[model samples]
Target: MKTLSIDIETYSPIDLTRSGVYKYTESPDFQLLLFGYAVDEAEVHVVDLASGRKIPEDVLSALTNPLITKWAFNANFERICLSRYLREHYPDYFTSYGEDVATAKYLDPLGWKCTMVLSASLGLPLSLKAVGQALQLEEQKMEEGTRLIRKFSVPGLQGRVLPKDSPEDWELFKSYNRRDVEVEMEIRKALEPFFVSPNLWDEYRRDQDINDRGILVDRNFVESAMAMGKRAQEEITGRLQQLTGLANPRSPVQMKKWLFSKDHITHTLCKKERAHFIAHTSGDIHEALVLYSQAQKSSLAKYGAMADSACSDGRARGMFQFYGAARSGRWAGRRIQLQNLPRNSMEDLDLARKMVKDWDYEKLSFFYDEVTDVLSQLIRTAFIPRKGYKFIVSDFSAIEARVLSYMAGERWRMEVFAKDGDIYAASASAMFHVPVVKHGIHGDLRQKGKIAELALGYGGGEGALKAMGALDMGLTEEELKPLVTSWRATNPHIVDFWWKIDRAVKEAIENHRIMRVGTLTIFMQKGILFIELPSGRRLSYVGAAMKMGEKGYKTITYMGVGATKKWERIESYGPKFVENIVQAVSRDILCHGMKNLQDRYICGHVHDELIIECPEDTPVYEITETMAQMPDWMPGLVMRADGYETEYYRKE
Candidate 1:
């Protein structure tokens, strides 16, 4: 058999949602109940493993055979689960497959293909059911699978419903397993035209390797932080109760009512509002508001997540999801979202971490005023390298800005990057027509320039400025309009690039023609709008069309996963498309860099940063220099990487 389409039903006492699949499978009670398979275009078959039936020997041989490709919806789940199964039941075959099962830790991903990744590559939904519905497949996923899974797979639910107890459900469960393989095969057939590139598959394999490598968690640090967070929360709750005399100060409704009744404050007690009230009010009200804001800091929850998802070896796996952001094809964070970890700005992070690990609450409180906030800032430190190794954390410097400049032919922005100069100050200088420095003459304008650069990059105007907190940064509402105009006026090429892309997209959809904007190519293929990036990776827009807007201009629209995460038709324009292109290119660059450094023990990555677990003697510049090397697709794009060596992971 050239291809093996498979699906599995697993039973585990571990909470798969809370702990990741790696930890879930580590449970001794974990069992692969049903193994369903279809070899090539043959009839689907279900091997009831839970009832003592064994998988066919030929099919089992095909699993370890590198020539035979295995296909599944979320293939990672199947590949990992089957790896455990093979090692346990078919030890000889598992060990003789060419790689050491002990050190390699799982099945080689080179022989596996994920249909979920394929669906995502086409800008389709990631779920099996959603993709089947989106593709209008003849064999759709069974809706009854969820109920049957809950009945049999889950443990401690009314004393574990077994096939002996519910024979009818058992038959349906086997059918559900068989139908999943059929649906997966149908998805592959439907998406056969848009074949996923080998490079992308190679990148997916690298992602799997990184996930399997798993980052070591500082168990002592995580446990201490969690315990400290609990105690700190109790103390803060008691203080708020004593001061406000409210039933629950943590409750927003209760706090808002109390604040309005006592202090005449009527605004919502969100982060910004709480800060405002604390600054304005005095005495117990001020103290209580400050305490309330401190209590609301949820960064410490990451510690709990790290603790939960960590495997028996004290490493967290499956934290990054490939193509999680389908629009830009950026990897999304799973279980313990390393993507959005709170920035650590504490001057004495090492001291605070040491105190917490020592469980010295008194010293910690003495050294830090807001102890809970300290814990929040120390969250990143929980991910530590294993003994005898250090984490060499490196990241591209202002990657998005550099990529936008390179693509738009913004010369001065490129110049800034080339010289390793400050883009924020350069942008401010260009916009205001004055020499702007970070802490020198007219340095105040740098903040305005920084905010303007961030907000106005994607064709944002006054509203974007406000959303970026311009008013809080001391910029007036009147200044936002002029700042946007000034930014656009200074970066004329970028503005032109935006409209050029906009016009190209409009032409591609309306005229049914291929259009080129700068180094990017836009075309419509079978109702899908493909924007081919310089890296040769295409960003897809499904069901693309153009309609006359109320403003008398043609507005481009496409079917995509929207803000609410439902598949629907969404409107788009040039600047937005430019944003996607630039970010996607940045992602490609990151993947390229990771490929360059693949020989190193790269544990994990967060956005543009790569966290490498290496010997303490490894030079930090070696990793940074390799990452800064530009790809062959874009010759003139100036790239720079900066890094720091740390025993534990942290934002430097």
Candidate 2:
């Protein structure tokens, strides 16, 4: 067979939603219930494995054959599940390829194609049901599948009804399984014209390899942190109860009522509001508010996630989702979200971690006033390097800023980068006509320059400045408008770039003509707007059109997953498109770096940073230098990487 489109139904005692497919399949009770397949758009077939039906020899061989391509929606799940199924059922077929069933990784991703990834590439929904509806497919996935899955697949649901117990539902479940394969095949055919490029497939393979490799987790550290967090929560709750006399001080409504009745503080208990009130209040009120804020830190729950998702080997797999960010095609954190882990700013993280791991709660409390906050900060330390190996954590320095400068042709900014000068200082020097330094002459202006650089690079205004915490940084409301104007005036080229992109998008949609702005190529094709990046990957905007916006001006709009995550027509502008393009390009540059370092043992990556497990002797500078190399497409772009070696993961 040249190609196989497959789907399967599985039953596992493990919680698949809490634990990823790798950990889910590790359960001894995991069973493959139904296997559906179609060979090259031929007749579809279903083997009721749970009903004791056996798959044909030819079909089984095709699964392990590298020459035959495999297609599925969310192919990673199918590939990983089938890998285990084969090892348990037909070991010879799995081992015939010289792979050890006991230690082999999932089936080679090279031979697999994911329809979900294809849909995501076109800015389509990632779910099979959503994609089927989004595409208006004739063979949509069966809605009855969910109820059937709950009845049969899940454990502890009324003694786990079997096929014999519910014959009709079992037959319907088989049909549901068959229909999924049919829908996946239809999706493949519909998306054939916009097939994922070979280079992207290579990148997908790399992502799969990283996920399969997994990251070592310190189980003892995670468990100890969880226990300490529980104790901290109890202590804080008790203190709040004793001071406020509230039955449930943790409840925001109760706390708000208590604050108003006792201290006459009439405001929401948000982080900023709490900080504001804390500064104005005194005595027991201030102490209670501080305790409440410390108790509100929920990041310590990540330790629980790590503990749940870790495999028997003590490694957490499937933490990163490839192409999870539909707009920018960036990887998204899955089970234990490493992307938003609380930053570790403690001076002695090693000592604190050791104390916690040793379960010395008293000592920890003595050193740290807020034990819950400390536990939140220690979440990153839960990911440790393997024995005899150290972590080389490297990431690009100001990747988005550098990319924005290169794309906008901001010469002064680029010059600052080339000379290794501080952009924030250079921006202050350019905007205010003063030589700004980090902690030297005119250093106070550096904060303004820093805020402006962050908020105004994408055509932000006074509102963006406020959202970036300009006021919290001690900038007045009156200064906000002037800062926005000064930043825009100083970087005329970047402002022009925004408008150029805006006009290009409008022209592409209104006139149905191709438009070029800088290194980007925009065009409309079959109701889709495509912006081809310098890396040759096109960002697709579905159902491109122009509409009269709320501001009484014609705005470019397209069908996409909007703020509510529903498929709808959303409005856009020049600066917003610039943000998307800049972020997308930045993601490509990161992928390029990962490609360069593919030979190394890359355990995980979060945004611009890569965590590599290597020998203690590995030179940190070499990894950083290699990651700093620029791609040929962006020749004049200046790039830099900063990294450090650590025994455990942490932010530098």
Candidate 3:
């Protein structure tokens, strides 16, 4: 297959982090500053069209070729920049647009391969500099060009392009741009051996396609949500001032002192206090540290940075990141953290929204003690329905848990999913060896069982249970260990699956052989371990090595223990990595389902849920059921999609 590496510098007045590509590149001021490219990995060339030089026919052809794949790091920018070029330069290509047309041909985000994705798939550190350092790629040796990059990226920042530009300035810009393309090509070559599945690439392309053709946005709902959020912000800031005698609630130093010294809260969420809290908490401080602990879960800046995502079209775009968490290949939230949003267990979200919006503080506080969940639901508010249309939401039922059961060959768990039994309650019953009657049927057994099944089964012990907020779910300290043990006893197959995978992976690493476990095929070579799925997609680990376990059994370990780039050290042979892979693979399955829905009904997807905006007369249930059906390739995996049609896109 022919491939062309490309890099372009473009300028836009629109804030990219908020309006996203579609809106950003569409700005009237938007103009490509420079274009750099390489064909078949040759000498990088610069094309300064701003110099009024006639563009070469071959370069033009390479730019528009549907089959000649384009390569760039952060390929989203490339796709959008090229798309702007195509639309402005050629209009006739739109006359007969097909369903599978590259999104850049239609809009933006469709026709490129992101080296960032390849880097993530290999679990390499993000950023071109980091990738270059990790792979030791030579072309990425340029020194501190941040200021140079910004000079070209920002229009009129360095100087307004003259009607006839200076040749020397243009040359520098193109060289810088060309270096990016060359670096991207080199990085992709370095990572080629990792071999991400073509199927996965196809799915990724489809994801970009979905993003290019963004869903219909509801201006009114978004406006209302922001208005209500503003009101809440005022109330919270006012309360904080009254409580702490501080003017700025957003001030970290002020809030930190207030929380620890003035309010007698003792606990803090910053990393500096991590060791202190860990030492003093006596290892069983869930209730005492819930607020501070939750704060630590994400960057404190994210709390205030949420406001920066607002867009001019009255629609907040890029709310959901497509494969943002490349290490696991999970979709992280960009403007809003949609994946980690609070689940709506409460029935009436409308009432909750109204309560928060109308300043009904007493009622809102009574229903949900804190505004975290309320604020989380506000993230969903960023997505709104079209004027005449509404959201037909359909989501897989207990998907990851069900996939765990199916993949583990757990008959009991499979049966629960197959029969429409409450998997959590059933898991509780299985663990506790009780009938698992309704919530009222047992004495605290219900909570214990529920928390145990959800938490401990995934190689989680008391700590994991606590991390999942089991204590906050209202399980007592005395019951934690017992619940953990009972969960291990109940889901024997899943527990076995963990060990089975560990053994298979360890053996593969030690022997340099390919081993199969159920639907997962383990491929080991050198220090890399790959778990290939039935869909031809693979989850890979780099530089995996074996270490001795407690009973002399082999345990797998890898470099880069934590999320930070500099934190490269071996940790534990834990379930965190495995869980990440399974979830990513599961998301792949859901993406396949979305592809299926594309043939009939699918407006877009928000996280794991699909929003199908169809005619009121359409059979929404059939759409939901069809989405729930698993591919023939994955027979053991049971699937179910649950949804409701709403006039507005709000949780039912």
What are the clashing pairs of model 2? none
Between prediction 1 and prediction 3, which has the larger TM-score?
Answer: 1
lDDT digits (tens) for residues 516-621 of candidate 1: 8878889998889999988888899989998676789768999888999898888999999999998999999999999999888888999899999999999999
Candidate 2, 391-469: lDDT as tens digits? 9999999999999999999898899999999999999999999889899999999999999989998888999999999
Per-residue CA lDDT of model 3 for 447-497, tens digit only, reads 676677677656989898888877667677887888778788877888888
Clashes of each: 0, 0, 0
User: What are the candidates' C-alpha RMSDs?
Assistant: 1.6, 1.6, 5.5
Candidate 2 structure, TM-score to reference: 0.98
Off by over 4 Å in 2: 95-105, 263-267
**Ten contiguous residues minimizing lDDT sum, candidate 1:** 95-104
Query: Whole-model lDDT for model 2 versus the true structure?
Result: 0.89
